[model samples]
Target: MTLRIGVIGTGAIGRDHIRRITNDLTGGEIVAVTDVNAESAKNVVSELHLNAKIYENGHDVIKADDVDAIIVTSWGPTHEEFVLASIAAGKPVFCEKPLATTAEGCKRIVDAEVAHGKQLVQVGFMRRFDKSYRQLKKIFDEGKVGEALVVHCAHRNPTAPGFSGDMAITDSFVHEIDVLRWLLDDDYVSCQVILPRNTRFAENGLQDPHMILLETKKGIRIDTEVFVNCKYGYDIQCQIVGETGIANLPEPQSVLMRSEAKLSTEIYVDWKDRFIDSYDVELQEWIDSTVKGEMNGPSAWDGYVVAVTSDACVEAKHSGGIVAIELPERPAFYDQGNNKVL
Candidate 1:
């Protein structure tokens, strides 16, 4: 049976998901879509020439009985509402990162799913699907990287979005928080944000860069380098250091074919270049899982942990001090191989 998919928010990622479902690869078909920018939504529907229905709002799309699953790429604040509505409608939903803008918001979505007594929401943290990151995990799990000691994660973008600092913590670094927790299979106990010397490359009044230090429940430490304006390239890197060995994601190596006098490979200037395949793999899994009545990606628990940690990061950034991240005790529900962090 082909799963009927509904996509909300016709922005870049939203349109990309629609394209993925309609053209590239799919276990489902996009049956409906919505966006606050109705003009863009109409444009997408017309551009794709897909007969999918267009709705004025996400609520209408999710409530439509035909929607078997939902892909939520809307603004961060609206995620909680649509996700909870989908849960109420008993439809599986794939929400982009930060599940919600606040920890309280995330909790509401989590509680809704818990009340439903099943997993119905999958949060987007695409790093888990990246081949290089998965290879690093495999090597770490093989004990090639002995007793994991520390992990250094970096997320740098070539430019900053025209949003607030809250966005920096929520929409952006939230991915770092979630993926790090998943990689180490540990919960964060606290977080501290350190502001570096301001970079002239950033826009006026923009924070430009910061460092997030996180400590896990099991004492594994993680340092995340977050810079929105590196003036170099779009980059994501992680190095896992263990008592016995070290493993890290190698940069994209290319065959340097002789051309003009310049010996060069390729540098991704944007995320659409660097993580496009990862996004595709992530969405494909989501579609396949929706068809099978199962999910393998990050769970609501993962989203909750990230929300809790990101909240703490925001506080740390505001208070100019380290803040404790209090997480509920780990539930046995995630203890299965699905979350076996090395």
Candidate 2:
């Protein structure tokens, strides 16, 4: 049975998701889509020839009884409402990162999920589905890397997302908070943020770069470098150092040949180019698992952890020092590393 999907937003990533579902993946079809820009939404629907119904707003799309699952790719501020509405309708929802703008808002979603007595929300942290990252996790589990000790992560964007300095932590590097926590299977205990010397390449108002130091509950440490306007490439790389070995993501394309001294393979300048396959795999798995009454991605607990840690990191950034992160005790429901009840 094809899972009926309703997509909200129809912006860059939103429209890409529609294409992925309608053109690339099976077991799912986009039935309806909504965007504040009706012109763009209609153009997207027509271009895809999905015969998808267009709505004036996201709520109309999600509220349609025919939508089995709703994808909340709308503006970040609007995530909480659409997610809760999907829950009220008893339909599964996949919301993008920064689940809510604030910790309390995320907690409300968590409360709703718990009240519903089942998992109905999956947060979009696509790094968890990337093949290279998955390989690193397997290596850690296999003990080839011995006891996992530290993880170094970098998220560099070729350009800023037309936002202010504050959003650098909330909207941009939030993926690091989500995926790193998922990889280590532990909650963050504290976060320390630092601003490096500014880079001139960034637009004057932007911060250009920052650093986040995170310590997990089980004592795993992560140092993250976030440079929004790197003037280099869009890169997401991590190196996990264990007692025995070190595993890191290979630079996406390593085949460098020098012909005219301008050696280059390809530097992904955007998320679409860098994580294209991961995005496809991520959405495909979600559709497949939802069809089977299962989930194959980050849960509400994961979202909560990321939100709490992000909140702490933001505080640390503002206070100019380390801030303690207080995460709720792990529930038994999330103890499994491979999606099984412990």
Candidate 3:
């Protein structure tokens, strides 16, 4: 059965998902869409040659009977409302990162889902579906890593035009927050942010390169360097050091060139190019599981935990000290054993 989908938000990521669902994926069809920018949304409908109707607002699209499930890719601050509406409508929703902008908002969605008595939300954290990351996780699970100890990570971007202020932590580093927790299968105990000298290319007073330190409950240490204006290329690296061995994320395959006494390979310029396959796999899994009345990726609870951790990181970034992360007990309703990390 093809699931009729309603997509909210027609921004870059949203439009990309529509293209994936319509062209690259199966078992789903985008029948309706809405975005804050009406003109842009209309243009997308025409540009993509989609036979979807444009709703005046997101709520209208959710209420439409033609939409079986909803996908929320709207602004971060508006996620909570649309997700809650989908729940109230008794439809499964796939929400992009950040279940909400605040921990309290996330908790509300959690409470509503728990009250409704089912799993109806999937948060988008595509790294869990990346093949390289999955391989590293499998090695750790198979005891090849032998009790993981430390992880060194780097997230670099070629350029960020409007990135500034706390967005460095909230917008970009948040992915690491979620993926690292899943990688270690442990919750964070405390977080600290170290801001080094700013890059001259940074705009709007944004801190160019920042280091985040996270300590898991089991004493696993993880450090991530976020460089938004590195001016090189989009690169993500992670190396895990364990007791007896180590594992690292494999680089993207590229044709090696040797010329003029130099050997070089191409690096991705944007995240969409870097993690495109992961996004496809993530969405496919979400659709397949939702059809079976199940959710297979990061849950609303994971989203909430990440939000709490992000808040701590932001606090640490501002105060120049360590901030402790306090999370609530995991409820039985969301428990699915060892698969929780995925």
lDDT for every model? 0.83, 0.83, 0.91
- Tens-digit lDDT track of model 1 for 1-342: 888989999999899878877888857888899999999999999998877999989999999988899999988779999999999999999999868877788888878887887788888889899888788878877889787788898888888757455666676788778777667666777889898897887775767688889888788888888888887888888999999988898786557766798777767778876777888999898888778888778887788878888878888988998899887765655554265443
The candidate that achieves the highest lDDT relative to the unseen native structure: 3
Error of 1 at 138 (Å): 0.3
Q: Tens-digit lDDT track for model 3 on 163-206?
A: 76888778888899988889888889999999999889998988
What's the lDDT of the predicted structure labeled candidate 2? 0.83
Q: List, residue by residue over 249-337, the lDDT tens digit for candidate 2.
A: 76775577777878768778878877888899999999988998876588777777777888888889889988999866656655542
Better of 1 and 3 by TM-score: 3
Which residues of candidate 3, in runs, are more than 4 Å off? none
**Model 1 regions more than 4 Å off:** 257-263, 331-337, 340-342
* Candidate 3: RMSD to truth: 1.2
Lowest summed lDDT across 10 adjacent residues in model 2 is found at 333-342
Q: Candidate 1 lDDT (Cα, whole model)? A: 0.83
Model 2 quality (TM-score):
0.94
